[model samples]
Target: MAEIAVLGAQGQLGRQFLAVLGRRARGLGRAELDLGDADAIERTLRRLRPQVVINAAAFNDVDGAELRRQQALAVNAEGPAELARLARTLGYRLVHFSTDYVFGGDRLRRPRRESDAPAPVNFYGYSKLLGEEAVLGAGAAALVVRVAHLYGGPSWSAGRANLVERFLARARAGQPLVITRGQTLNPTSVRDLVPAVLALLRRRSAGLYHLTGSGPCAAAEFAREACRHAGLCAKIQWISRDPRPARRARYTPLANQRWSQEGLPPMPHWRSSLAEYLLSAQNLPIRD
Candidate 1:
């Protein structure tokens, strides 16, 4: 087992990485490894020095990011930049996860590619975009995997309210579930994601890759599928993306031709991934 160091190991997405990597990897949460402390991050990376560092950390609250611009920039932008720089210096391969928000949704028809121009609509997007630039600029042996609509965490991730979790809770409570029929994304599940990320590191495929689920779907369609999978009967209320106060990418679905060019298999459809996600969530051991 190649020793891998995972920053933000306690976070929802970070924990998914831990689960996939298991006990073979050294998992460091914020307490154990602080991103704000560059010296600490570098010192630890150099001394314990894992072969690969997977950065799942990000300041991702879209609305909250608008209110706290500096905070978002620090974590989403500066932190990854610092880590990637340190990784290059210390000779550790870096696998950094970025987001779809990097692209502003002006051209919904044209699927955003690795080369598409990024025009972030909000502070969160801007910060994440900055992080992407930072990592790429570091010019380390890196694989920047961009994904969207993520679900499956070590924790239930109630606060984030990912598609499956939101729909399941609503159906369980018999609450009306209204989703944005206007906004679109290919839901990328953690199960499929973690494996692909690990595989990428092995291949040493260094560049930007659009690793989303097989295709795109509106939020409403995702909700309906979630309801069906979870065996819940809730009246799905459909709404447009415009009704939401936040400015989101209207239709910036990513194209996956890069995956083909790299000769990697297409990720399983969102529906298949979601079914597995729901099953695993249900079978989770009871937490204290």
Candidate 2:
């Protein structure tokens, strides 16, 4: 069994990584391994000596990154660089997660491929792109997986409410909801993502991969689908993307063509995955 260590274990994706890895994995959150601290990360990795280090930790505040550029670069860029260096020295495989925001949606590309040039529209995306560069530059055995519009999996998701949660919350209260229109993305669930990621690791795949739901849809479409699965009859209002505090890319959907060509299994469509997530939430395990 490969010795696996997951950073940011408290996050939605991290928790699912832990659940998937089971006893073969050790999870380290900020308290155990702070990505911002270089010496601390090196020391902990030395002590643990994990054969595979999965960097699920990230400063994922897209809007906040604009204000905290230095903070974002520290955790999102420098942190992954350090991890890559350590992985090289320790002879371990490094798996890092990035975001689909790296691509500028205004470009002609509809669904971004692994080989597409990255032109981030926001500070957060730029930081993650830097992290990818840092990790790849270190020349270690690494895989940089980029994902988008992530939701579902563990209930404890670092205090971030996903699209489904936001829609369901308003629907349950019978309140009117306003969702952005014109903006399109593939809303992905962590449950569908985790197993695919594991398989990639098992196959020792290297380089970058874009993993998300199969199809793209507007944010309003995603909300309506969630409503259908959750059985919520709530009025929804669609609004233009203008007048937002932060500038978001318009149509940044990721394509898994490279992964597919590699003969790996395809990810389920957005609606199917969303339905599974809603069902899973209702069937939590009971403990005596």
Candidate 3:
């Protein structure tokens, strides 16, 4: 059995873990391991018997969740609860990913700490919040890391492309970009997040932690910065709100208070990580 097992291997973040963890880790995508299937999850894990299980799978469509509540709940809430149960019985550490959407009522623009009460505004956020509660309350060895605006990872599907990739593609194609304005988030880099997670595992850290880039910015501003770094000039139209049916919080910057207090390495500013990713070989084939 591999030392580590990563579920959701086909996802952007999951792919990063598979790539970074290399041979020591085994990846199980939806085809290999379905989170919604409790028996399958238990049977598979019992066979692998990995020392650590990292759950990266989730029904992440914020607006889509409004229409498909059951699908979202099954994958995001119920599935995680089962994983937590197995982690305790099987005696393996579990690392689960969560989101900033859990604190939807934060209109005051304060950086939310782990201790802050969660008030999800949309079904997607609500489902994830449920998952967080289930995992943490299960009395299992688990790490629930809440992140925001993840970028700089391999997109498993065309629709899964992150903010940085979307902006870069549009800019390279000489297309004007339309971005939301009021929503603020810490645009985290998968590259940076992967290492921080590894550090937490090395230290055997558990419980809830907000793991995101150092600071936050408006979505429009983040797009502009991405274009600037790529030496691309593109017209950007900003809108006050997203036209989607789902309600989104205007300000939800997650503060890495627990991570910092634990003496973990400080996460780089969002801009610094963005620049590094845009300039790196991962983002190549620049036209013009």
Candidate 4:
């Protein structure tokens, strides 16, 4: 069996990766280890000495990160740089997760390929882009998989704000969900993502890749689909604004042909995967 180490085991992506790769790797969360201190992270990796290392930890609060840019950079950029350097020195393969936010400023019509020039808009995107830069600069064996709008877990995880939580928040209160119809991207599911990441571990393909849902849709359509899955029959009122508060990428749905050419499957369309998430969540207690 291949020995692997997973950081951020408590996160949506990390937890999903662990559930999908159970009994096949070693995992750690902030409780067991922290990524803030680069030296500590390196020490943990050195001690484990795993063949594959997955770094899922990140400063993910997009709005909050605007105020705490340095902290975001520390975890997303500086910390990963240290891990990449150490991984290169130790002769181990590394895998890092980034976000679609990396290309928000560019309002392009075509699907953003892995080769597109990165021009991040917000502090969060800037930080993640820096992390990608660090990973490449290390010159180690690593793959940076960029994903968007992931929503799923082993259970009905109802905290820290996911797309599911946002949907549920509106549904339970019988309120109108005013979602943007202009924005578009691959709204990925964590279930689809974890499996692909595990597949990469088996092969360790080193390159930048898009690992997202099959198709792109507006947030309005996505919200309606989510409500349908939640056993709710609520009608949402679509609203248009002059300029949205968030610096959203007009249309950055990713193309995953690269991963497909290597025989790895792309994430299923958001609707299919989301239906599975809601049905599975029926048993878990619905938060009021």
lDDT of all predictions: 0.78, 0.86, 0.90, 0.79
Residue 252 accuracy (lDDT) in model 1: 61
Alpha-carbon shift of residue 229 in model 4 (angstroms):
2.0
- Put down candidate 3 lDDT per residue, 38-115, tens digits, no spaces: 899999999999999999999998999999999999999999999999999999999999999998885567899999
Candidate 3 deviation (Cα RMSD): 1.5
- lDDT per residue (tens digit) for residues 42-126 in model 4: 7888788888888988898887788888899898999889888988899888999998889865447877788888888888989
Q: Distance from true position, residue 136, model 3, in Å?
A: 0.2
Task: Report lDDT (Cα) of residue 287, candidate 4.
Answer: 43
Q: 1 or 4, which is superior by lDDT? A: 4
* Candidate 4 Cα lDDT to native: 0.79
1-288: candidate 1 lDDT, tens digit per residue: 448988878777788888778876888787877776777777778787788888887776888898888888888878888888887788888888888888886655766888888888878888888888888889888888888878876456534666677677777777888765566778888878889888888787887888888878777778787777666775877666555445787676778768877788988988888778767755442222
- lDDT preference between candidates 2 and 4, better one: 2
Q: Score every model by TM-score.
A: 0.91, 0.93, 0.96, 0.91
Which one wins on TM-score? 3
Q: Which segments of candidate 4 are over 4 A away from where they belong?
A: 154-158, 237-246, 281-288
Prediction RMSDs, each to the true structure? 2.9, 3.0, 1.5, 2.5
- Window of ten residues with lowest summed lDDT in model 1: 279-288
